[model samples]
Target: MIDNEPHKTKAYIAGVNLNDPNFDYYMTELANLTEANNMEVVGQSRQNTEQIVAGTYFGLGKINEIKSMAHGLKAKVLVLNDELSPVQIRNLEKLTKLRVIDRTELILEIFANRAKTKQAKLQVQLARLQYELPRLHPSENSLDQQRGNGGSTGGGFANRGAGESKLEMNRRTIDKQISAIKKELKKVANQEDIKSKRRNKKQIPKVALVGYTNAGKSTTMNGLLKEFTDESSDKEVFVKNMLFATLDTSVRRIDLNKNFSFILSDTVGFISKLPHNLVESFKATLQEAKDADLLINVVDASDPNMIQMIRTTQSVLREIGIKNIPMITAYNKADKTDRNYPQIEGNDILYSATDEKSIKLLAKLITKRVFANYKKFNLLLPLSDGKTLAYLHEHAQVMKESYENDGVHAEVRLAPENQERFKKYLV
Candidate 1:
């Protein structure tokens, strides 16, 4: 028998730091991203500089040193900490004799590998193509043929002389693919919009969970779903202890009690220096957060770089055009820290998502923030007006109900909009 397991590439990570306070944290993230892409991080290097080198990312001497070190470590790939210019990537690869991959490309590769759904696959593909469009070179005119043949050359001298025309053809093909993907994405988004409108008609508030990748957003979602939702495997989203574990958005109606119900969504997690193209492509998936009434910004309280991670999430949210929405800073993973679990600070909470009591407290906090405008109302509907009564049952929190000779009497908690709509039947 022959063994046929694919070999993992050995990657050496490096970055040029311009005295950034978060330089080490960023390099750590680069290494993690490398591992997430199924590459083994065999070595690392960093250089402090006043500014990045324009032609080559690192100083010539630094590059030479990195080349020697990587050679010694048997590294086959050089992963940089920041997005590099096309010229820089080419120069570095020529000087070091190793494949050069920038931060943006690495992140995109991880996303491409992790995408499971058609929407996610299309989104990642769009971002990857956009990243490559600007980096195309005249010498790489065979790119279209290579991609068309599934990422491999046909092992012949065919089309060895074609130049400008081939590049133009490749560009046009990519442009056409981009347009087709956008059209398909629009169709999927329209379907989602219809469902969202249905949820909107129910008059329930929406809350979205967002945070740094692997900072426990999916775990938190599972915890809430397990405790509040009827036990069903399909109701739970996938939970894993890895970066970018959840790529698709998952929405579930969480009924906290007979008197409380709101829509909860778990969105794709954010990361520092996320590629702009990726964000643009994911806009449809992230619309849930954009339309949310409240956002729970989950943080890993146990991580030493928690503050930086929080800032990264906030920056990404702003880039995604989410502004002025109410948010609660949920410092999760309290069990990993020494602080008491389920502790509440103003506009923030320190809690473990896996704890039942902590989940209950989180639910209460969400209800308080999302339902702040709801008010109690006493109403009487005519016995024949069964439609209105049924509407109330579906949309409002019915505190009390009874049948009377004159009509059906009930006390309910209604949102501000609902309160006005049912004013005619008020007691």
Candidate 2:
């Protein structure tokens, strides 16, 4: 889909830190996330508290101060860098007199606005409902109690049929909507399952890209694909540098050349202290990560909290039961940083995908790492068999090839599945 840049809105952002070291990075990323969603940061406020205040997010005094500052600046919106409770949200709204949003709510609103596809829409709705389900207002919870008025048997809507109370009716409506979204998501999953099965049948390797929010996962995905595909064609390749840029999993068949096309999947990125409801809702979408044969864990080389981000990503990966998968850490954005080295231990590669040489290095490393798990084979094909020769050149690494009187003698290294295809051509 074509993307027209959005008009930016001026807003104020605040972070309440209980003396945490990562507070600065969190607030910084929060600002960027807001900007990505077309909000301009007019000002920022940070409050240090010995303990988190229960009533207001940043203690009563700091809340008043922020309110005064926002009022003076005429900020259109007030964004909290931390997660705010429902009561706190309501209280803050009353005090600040501006639209107050917590980080989770802000992220959900961004996802809701950015979702374009049917699967993406369903995913966002499921996530939003899940987030809302537990945060229902006290009055809303009372609606769940369907005890009829005046203790009469016909308490609710009083009808000949079994009518529900106002509260029960609301709950039923929400439940029905949730159920419908899940049902639609299941259909999309089934379709994806069929595609997954077909790839397995062909013995294609599945590689998934996972990282923290705004670590450039989607940008890297675009660079990887664009490296191989002719992007100048009428078909425009979608690449957004924004956080959660690619909400829905986009699986593309990448030609590793020499008869091998491995599947590359761009999955949702993980975040520090990600809300549980969002995680639970996105489980199906993240199943693509768990099922991956290899994981390309992307990291922002310029981020100060790179270590924390790494741990957060690992925490989620463990939660998903992906313990023993081989991973290649791709430290991205080397171009913008003073230095691009990460001290993390792993089979890793560091490069800005924007650089042509970096793209080549990444592609080469990908091919090398993926083929390491496969067996090698040698075969002889006739020179007249142009089709098989061309196939070999496209999908396999031809270590040795020679023109012969009878045919062509070729020794190749490839995945085992290609072994059978070359069997008939073997001398």
TM-score of every prediction relative to native:
0.91, 0.77
List RMSD in Å for every model shown: 3.8, 7.2
Specify the poorest-scoring 10-residue window by lDDT in model 2: 148-157
Worst 10 residues of 1 by lDDT: 149-158
Report residue 20 deviation for candidate 1 (angstroms): 1.7
Give the Å error, residue 266, model 2. Answer: 1.6
Q: Residue 190's C-alpha lDDT in candidate 1?
A: 92
- Candidate 2 residues 58-167, lDDT tens each? 77778788888887887878998878788888788888888888898888888889788888888888888877765654243434455433223343444413333444
Tens digit per residue, CA lDDT, model 1, 54-84: 9998999999999999999999999999999
Evaluate all candidate structures by whole-model CA lDDT and list the values in order.
0.90, 0.76
Error of 2 at 335 (Å): 2.4
Q: What is the clash tally of candidate 2? A: 12
Most accurate candidate by lDDT:
1
Quick one: best TM-score, which candidate?
1
Off by over 4 Å in 2: 1-9, 138-165, 229-236, 338-346, 378-427
